[model samples]
Target: MFRSNSTTDCVQHITTSVELTPIRNYISELNLVHHSKRVFKLKLNFPKFIVICNNNGARLLELQSKVEENWIDLQCRVRGYGIGVWLGLTDLQREGQYVTMSDACRPRYSNWMRGEPNNGNGNEHCAMYWITRSGWNDTVCKGKINFVSTFKDAMIFCNNLGAELLELQSKAEENWVDLQCRIRGYSYGVWLGLSDVRTEGQFVSLSDARKPRGNFRNWAKGEPSNGGNSEHCVIYWTTRIGWNDARCTDKFNVACKKQKEIAYD
Candidate 1:
């Protein structure tokens, strides 16, 4: 039995004419990786098994056969290690291939042949080994491969997707606020961004010049201090009205502006 002290340490096994059925059985006993509810699938079929780290599905298609020659690893500093491993396995399975999934944190190999330790550390958070009917064959698989270079790269990909979703939600909220302001006929002054200073006994607009651009401006009541000529102004939400100095850098719910209709005789 091949045992590893740490999941990151590499284990090399040489099987002696073992059948595929037993190999599959041994792999089943090991732990399976988990991923997010959403997944991206890939289609790459090979008789040999593959080992990958950190569950990077997006870059799966870019994998090349050359990676098989030397041990490949990826290191991503993301919070979700399980999700990353699950995604990589999911992509492999989608390609009609059952993969041996293991983590750099916990690795367990079944009884098999052995050699000198081929341990390594690199961009690979996960590693994949191509398995064949010959039983854990070691021939370089052929394909184009893409590798992750840094933690920032992985973060940028995830963050950009999140930002896009938020932008869409904000647009919808603005539309709702606009409808509310128009129906009120300017009678209800839409306090788009107002706050009260609880300690200073005053209500102030978030747009106060004295306030920094990073304050939380919920306008809770008696905020803004109003220490220096800081009366809240009725700035059009569509124009500069929505922003106050209090919550300059802080993200807040956006309000819409409605113009008063002029009556012509």
Candidate 2:
């Protein structure tokens, strides 16, 4: 984009620039500058605008939607400054019970940077972007810095330390899991722990290799259709009762459950 000699053309350019549909587009258009004579500088004059975080995760998705090389370029653009700053609000503070997002959403989707939501200060309730790595982190909701706020992750761990895919034994568990999925901002698919590696269409638990209870079959319409007969893994989704039959190698948000073991000795 460049400035033209004609005044009429400049009017069109400026109008198009500020007409971005999403707020993220606005941020990108503004081009925050940390040093002198670079780009548009941020001013804290607006006190009447509303703050929202529920949509932060969506921007992250858009950022990752770009090609890897392009993503690197965007990262540099944001990282021109030093530390992570607010991009949006998050609900990581509830510790599994709840999430407080910048906006109200039934189920939140989270794309936490690696090992994040580590519960910083136990008071970190908002989302921040780590400019250096272009990863997301949870920060104090009311911290000094302002404004701002996953793509599906690749599977690095082949095994879950002998743990099986999560098997929901009750309605409450299923609802809770679904809620968590939404809160994390997942709308399409989320990988579950059920697979048919052993017995072709029959799904079994990765832990005990037992067939799941027959009553609670959550299959999306025409699902488990195994379109090409190659989908052996399952992914739970809130939109569909029947989880999606996906390829095991596909990247997705994985679900892990921790159980306390009682010592008899």
Which candidate has the top score in lDDT? 2
Instruction: Give each model's clash number.
Output: 44, 24
Alpha-carbon RMSD, candidate 1: 20.6
- Evaluated against the true structure, the overall lDDT of model 1 is 0.24
- Give the Å shift of residue 241 in candidate 1: 28
Every candidate's lDDT:
0.24, 0.44
Give stretches of model 1 more than 4 Å off.
1-78, 82-108, 111-265
- Candidate 1 C-alpha error for residue 159, in Å: 11
Residue 237 lDDT (model 2): 59
Question: Which parts of model 2 have CA positions greater than 4 angstroms off?
Answer: 1-163, 260-265
Per-residue alpha-carbon lDDT of candidate 2 for residues 1-265, written as tens digits (9 for 90 to 100): 2332321111011122322122233232111112212112223111111122122322222222224324433533432323443443456544633233334442243456788867676876555556556666766554432121111121222132323345666676677667655543344445666789777899876656777654466777778877677788887755674477887755344444435210000
lDDT of 2 at 48: 10
